[model samples]
Target: MGTERDKGAEQGTVHYSGTEGGWGSVRGIVETALRERPKPAALDALRRQNKPGGFMCVSCAWTKPKHPHTFEFCENGAKATLWELTSRRCTPEFFAEHTVTELKGWKDYDLEQTGRLTHPMRYDHATDKYVPCSWNEAFDAIGRELKAIDPKSAIFYSSGRASLETSYMYALFARLYGHNNLPDSSNMCHETTSVALKDVTGSPVGTCILSDFDLCDAIFFFGQNPGTNSPRLLHPLQEAVKRGCKIVTFNPIREKGLEVFKNPQSPKEMLTPAATPISCLYLQVKTGGDIAAITGMMKHVFAKEAERWAAEKIHVLDVDFIEQHTDGFDALKAHVDGTSWEQIEQESGLVRADIEAAADVYIEAKRSIAMYGMGLTQHVHGSDNIKQLVNLFLLKGNIGRDGAGISPVRGHSNVQGQRTVGISEKPELVPLDRLAEQYGFEPPRDEGRTTVHVCEGIQSGEVKAFIGLGGNFLRAIPEQERMEAAWTTLRLTVQIATKLNRSHLINGQVAYLLPCLGRSEEDMQVTGAQAVTMEDSLSCIHGSIGRATPASPDLKSEPAIVAGLAKATLPPNPKVRWDDWVADYGLVRDAIEETYPEQFHDFNKRVFTPGGFYRGNSARERVWKTKSGKADFTLPKKLNSWGTEDKDGRWRLMTLRSNDQFNTTIYGYSDRLRGIEGTRDVLLMNPDDIAAAGLKQGQIVGLASDADDGMDRQVGGLTVTPFLLPRGCIGGYYPEMNPLVPLSWHDEESKTPAGKSVPVRIVV
Candidate 1:
């Protein structure tokens, strides 16, 4: 059994191995597989993961290689697979044994560990438990409730796990039902990237492909840990390092993944302790300090260019690209010039010399890739952070090239694809006219609610229904306690999922838990076995066909479930053939192709070929699709000044995930890389901060948000563990630290919860 801990007490010790992914990773995979019942099936599914004609790993959105290895899957991918293909079943009998009230007290990990949901179940008010219900009964009841409520009051939330087809169908169904409240997982994480990238580059997606890693002279990582999050990516990074490419990292904590990696696939490496060094230089930037850090780098570049020009008339800036392909260079240069070194040093928590050193690396490199994750987003100035990175890249002309570009390392498998296929809250983002013309219904033009808006809507009783297309929605969002209570106010809640989660237990007046096929499970439709396609972080669309048997014969495919809900709810539209699309899925692809002719012209045929087809990015061709028709060098009004000071003894806290966890899914309690074992409630603090707070290591403490929002937000029993973090900057696992972030505490432009930087005071 996994080590158990008290809810609010420290149950683990601090031990940093300074390495990631070697024998430890292999052990983790083996242990995970051993724990999962029906081991043969789990092991078989693992081998097929990420292979051509195999299911996509339902973990991160990292792209796969064209010529794959025997074990293309990572440790987390294996855990995710075993997690989905587990023999443990949450049958009707299991639900009958546990009441909603009782299940509410269980840990989120325990809830999921109950395993794959086998049957459709509805909340029984009298028993406070979910009772088995026929598919027809559940659908009819949901349809009636949906019909009763105003379409605007209903929120359709799509998790990143949903395929392009399922998401496309989901968005279509929601719009056909008369509303555009299609908030998704992206709203909370990369909405800032979407909002910022679109303004800078015509496209919101990353321009670099998987192969770009090989050609780049340098790769800069900001706020993302590839080892735990996207381990498969480490392989390329490993190869890149071997080929003498520089890896630079800027993050609060020195992530083990970015430090060193041992390829588990390599027999020699597995037998030996030799590991590839990932980051050549690591900058421990303060929380919310990325903007200042980036600005400092840009300033250094400009300063160097001036010095070089004065000495030998040598040009450092990409003069041709900047003058012809980009706008706002002069304004950005002036902004950087006006910014003082003292301000940069103070805000970024780094010496000017160190910043210059990092900048020197960028200036010297022939080509570089600036890759960032939620760390750059999830801030009050999140959009500005992304904009500044783009500006930095633009100065050197890193984008629109073979070896360099801006790559936002996305988390979810198809989060980017969902946005591409119109799973957006912004009606302007989606091709509404085409959708209307194709679906034969006038699509809603009114702006829809984002995830934060949905939370507010639920609080105000404005949102009456929520239909989740796969995700632990309630558990993943901020203001968890408040949201949980607000969730009860909903008239209807429908979750189409493969397994039981905390969200399902947060019952409403009329709630239905609809079981859906996992990515590893076979989806047999009328046309035969169905294959769904997912778009990776690099915008490569590929096919995923489940090779394992269905966990439960009754489980429906996500597309089929969406079709059922659409058929039961909407008035029949002759143009939208829900039955036919769900039957073949090829019909759905054909519609997608028709909807996005330029991107998915031959989606079905091309997606199955080799490593899948690239959804060509216009920005990569230097054809700026922005209003200015040129890449814009945006200037932030000021550097991020939020959560910098140690005012009122409050520390800047950034919520992060453990190696054992993905999004809100807790695979296990061990974060082997961080040396965290058996607990997720520990707070990682600098030794100086620990001493300054008059708190000793292993001391239990509570955290209270310093947000101006009237509500008192606090979580307790977090054990203080000292680490090498910037003073006044601490880190804690996400979802646990989510409560300290108010719903309103989000990016001004993207409204992505500023989960990366929350000011909180330690409560002893």
Candidate 2:
């Protein structure tokens, strides 16, 4: 693979910048699949679309009802759903032909290359094939092995894609299994935000919901590029601007999607392929410098208030809300006052004038909201960064008020809901206590490991078995190469998924692939079918029913699968009847309501409508729950904190997904936003770095992390494409370069590995 031409570049293989083929390849896959398909299932409202629904969108986590829009979904969301509905199946016959060693050589796309899982299967190591097995045999085998291992030696990983009902049941099953070694997808991304925000404000959810977005006069978005990640937000953004909301975005790279989005609802905009400009102010902030930028903005606000106070100006600061609602203001004020302009500028990569300008816009508005995403939280100091955002919002009396708050736009539909419905690796006392009271059994009390902690436990042999529900665990884990190693050591691994993925191959000594129904697929339960509850970004709990029929008669719903495993694993408890819950998921919801009366009213009665009720806080505008009895201002540790091993200017890095990907699934290889086509081999770099490295646009170069592990060979030749990014920073496609990220570099507080902030050197 040694095709590089540069003296400094010795890595093998310069991948082509383009896809080689085109959308024609995508069209071919669809056409070929349709031809081989037994039946075609068209999209429609879920069985409980207008009633209480229980499904989360397989797309981005922006929550809304399943309504017909001109733009049904984004390209990635469409791909996620299409892949779910694929008629092509990975049958036992196909697996019998390909050995694990041969399959190991296939690219991630090439393995999923087969199709969706059509039946439950177990790996036969002797034959090196995954042969079809009966549901009883598979579940019993998994249960027997899982029970043999002590619960502390087991780990449960979650994906953001799970529905609230499934997630709750998953949590219950795990708790009953006797350990809290629960790791979810959140640990990889927003775990720090959850930890930081809760410490400061006592809740892990974003302050602003959809209603707030509609009411806000101004919105400051940091580290979120909605165009590629949350395309559904583009609609709301377009609408907000139409109604005169000032939208500001703080991002390192100039994201084209945020800059321009074509709202199909608009007559003029929809007719053409061109996009409408969304973000009014685009601030080019530094990679790990968000805390500095937020602090700088607050300092400007403080200065403005000070000037107003000296002149005896009225209503300059929201002093009424500050005095009555929050604590720790004096400390925060002193920190801002003591911070030198030089430190702020050096750390933030933005000058005082620039920060002041953004502050001026914020201060001018009567009601303002600042929303963020994973872009701000994928650092060693990711939690500190989030607290600073909360500090800013609390400064202005944003929380417990209309049209103002701190918002973290989540990725998957029910990631927030899963956490609420008891999916926490470290569940709080309230939910656990209530769960025990409702179910008449003690819920496990010990805190569990998050996604990163679980993997580390696996690698260290502290954990033996792993059960993943609905996530592409192997591909989703950052530094996935290490995750694969950790996974291989496990005695048992279980994946309940809708599609075939690489996780099936990266197996433990004993592994099982349980095919489950998708959100798009029907989940026929007793009492004339059923619905599930999902918590949205806004804390709105809604119900979803699968509109399409199950792909295979063999496929079971998650609850049913959970019941199957529960029966086999634990001794039969009369009070905790798995059969009753599986018999009617409504019974599960009824139990959930018993545990959480505040959030869930009558779980069955409320879900009968399409627009589900909002959870208590968001619905009732209650602030009774926070530690302060109101929102609190949490101070971040500091922004200038560099990762210990990454201080050598080897380029602070962030892993990004192209528009064609969602979670661990790759729909296509092309990243239309960064202008890379048909592949993820290209790197987005600053022009300054390109010239300093003696490289040019389209010039192929090798990228390697500076940190030394057992392997000094973590380099790859990627075609360079220059962008207007901050110096000492670079961006590249993920999973392809996930190897460069070290597992140890994750945030300890949140256990979220720094996927957005790996340090690497470029050689040409």
Candidate 3:
């Protein structure tokens, strides 16, 4: 195995390691945006992106500062904007030219490139094509099918892209329709974050805000690559580095963004080419080793506290805070003391010395923030991974203080907000008492199916109808082929989207694609141009107004579509005025306030304020709402690195999105950050592993899982690329490798698939 140069790779697709975010990021922003949009149109969208009175970027959930500079959007943000605002249109005539069967043959990127949907379409089985239909006709058919099926047999699925207002309406519609089968994109991504955070800290959302970056003396990262996922975060990390903050990172792969970053917006940096070095200490943890690594850090911190206590008669642990704000410290301390350095080194792939060094930085810092992404949450023991992080932070009294807290770096623009406004399968999260009091209908109190369960329900013929409120549901979930077949089992499948995607192509017996307005497009109703609100990763709920022309006159807002469906399906009720809610979104906000008055008090008025308002966290106030009325340090009982020992040299595969991709949406073939271009069909692996397997670089290989799920579960024709990864670990692009993931493998509590850790062997 050798490097890209040694392998004599293709001209443009060569892979290499380099510093992240400089002129290259700027170039990528321009080139990607210009592909889908004209220069003027791209500039207009870019100018409006993340600006006050303008729409937020639909890319990542990274928050904007109270005061933002011009050109606040990043490269991926521009791509998402351009992808949505593209001038191309998928007219009814275009659908006439290509049948649903023909469109199914198109690649995901190619299908999105066909551009925005121009009209409501219903699949015509005779022609195997989707034809134009009126919004009423589409809604009426969906209502008829929904009425026919058992309400519990219908799944109301949401994508993270939907605004808080839209999500609230969708949730209400589902509850009012007499079903609680509400599953969203959060199920696949940060469901573990919600489950774990709430259990440990008594709150689900991130405790810290963007301002914490400035005040924190140390930032510890676990399994996150901000360079490609959330480039805007690099600026704050860069500033933190400049402030002499110790940024330590633990990830299986050595990401370039965590190594160093040069903000393109900084004129001084652009002029002098000075890039701030990020991640003062980077630890290469093994796949699925987050819990072990976190445990190691806590173990080291405990040992240090023991030494300090003996030497200076001073307590390193915050005994006062622990007594006041926490519980189960003694048990956690005992567990840490029992856990040996040998076990930590074996599971974490980090020696005791490195773990101690990291613990030293944390021990030295007065205040530190732990930041993580999907890497920590996409494991079988992901919930435990979070609990361990909380244990580490709470050990030093990190909760409820400035510059110190747990920050789960979210992906989609409003996933956290979606949950905030009540899009959950969990009945307790929904304000049912408030809903009954405000809307005059009793909601289903029983817990509902998540994404994984929804798939199982569909496959078992229990769920007959599925409605996706703005996401590529079929592609985002595991077992793509299985999901496609399961979708066919459904009686009705509805997709509320702006563009055609794989989900739309995979037809149920009766399928309808309802074209909706993109976030950046003007949403004109009887109240005139409307402004929507979304909550970012930092819990900042801000207003977003679209000024651009809608891609098509037929396009409706997501709220409008939800309202239309609700009105058509549910009987007229005095309290639930669907038409009034659609005519003006403020009415929706009023309803939201009524449902979640504690969080959304004065919601309509407060959302319009500059920089919006924060949905203040209980954990931030140190007011724990857990059963014990305090933060709890739960000990992880089961600890397995990779969730598999890999005795026979089985590689642990983790699925990741390319730099050019956002969620399930593919922008291009290039992952500029990793220096991989032209194709996404290559696997990044450790050179030693490749050599041991007798596989040369650039050689095609077939992947097969070790799971006995009785599924064939194989994806072939992947070129092996030698890269800097820990031993026994490998990486592949997601959706492509999703088939190799067994549906049975998921976090038991959260019900999230372990897409990041799969025990797989090379097929020779």
How well is each residue in 1-764 modelled by candidate 3, as lDDT tens digits?
Answer: 12244234323233545567788887877777667763355567678788777788888999877777688888888888888888889889999999888888888899998889989999999999889999999989999888887899999998888998899888988999888898999899999999989987889988998888899999999999998999999988988888889899988876778887878888887778587889878888888877777888888888888899999988878889999999999999898888887888888877788788888999999999999998988888888988989999998899899999999899999988999888999998877898888888889998889999999998889988999988898888888877887788789999998888999988889999999998888889998989899999889888898878888888888988999998889999999888888899999998888777788899988875656688899999999989899999898866653555566857789898888899889988988777788898988887777788888989998898887555677889999988777788899998889888887788877988899998887886
**In candidate 1, which residue pairs clash?**
none
- Residue by residue across 1-764, what tens digits does model 2's lDDT show? 01122112312222222221133223434543453342445344222222334344677777564343544455455556667766678788888888877888877776665777779999877888888899999988998898888888887777887777788778888888887776777777777777877777767777666677779988888888776777667777777887998887788766765566655345664444445556777777878888898888889999889888888775657898788767788888998888888889989887788788888888888888877888877887888888788788777777777788877888877787888878786767347776676666777787888776776788889888888887777777766776787678889988898767778788889988899888877778776576666777777777777767787889888888888888899887787868888778888888788778877877778774544566755312535356667665666677643464445547877778876677667766656655556667778777667788777888888777766554543657788877657777788877777778777777757868777777777766
* Model 1, CA-based lDDT: 0.87
User: How does each model score on lDDT?
Assistant: 0.87, 0.73, 0.85
Q: Mind sharing the TM-score for model 1?
A: 0.97
lDDT by residue (668-751, candidate 1, tens digit) is: 898888788899989888776777778898899999988765678999999989777787888898888888888888888989
Q: Which ten contiguous residues of candidate 2 have the minimum total lDDT?
A: 1-10
Question: Ten residues in a row with the worst lDDT in model 1?
Answer: 1-10
How large is the C-alpha RMSD of every model relative to the true structure?
3.9, 5.5, 2.8
After TM-score superposition, the amount by which residue 221's alpha carbon in candidate 3 deviates from its true location, in angstroms, is: 0.4
TM-score of each: 0.97, 0.91, 0.97
Candidate 2 accuracy as lDDT: 0.73
Ranking by lDDT: 1, 3, 2
Q: Output the lDDT of residue 564, model 1.
A: 87
Model 1 CA lDDT for position 720:
89
Looking at candidate 3, the ten consecutive residues that score lowest on lDDT are: 1-10
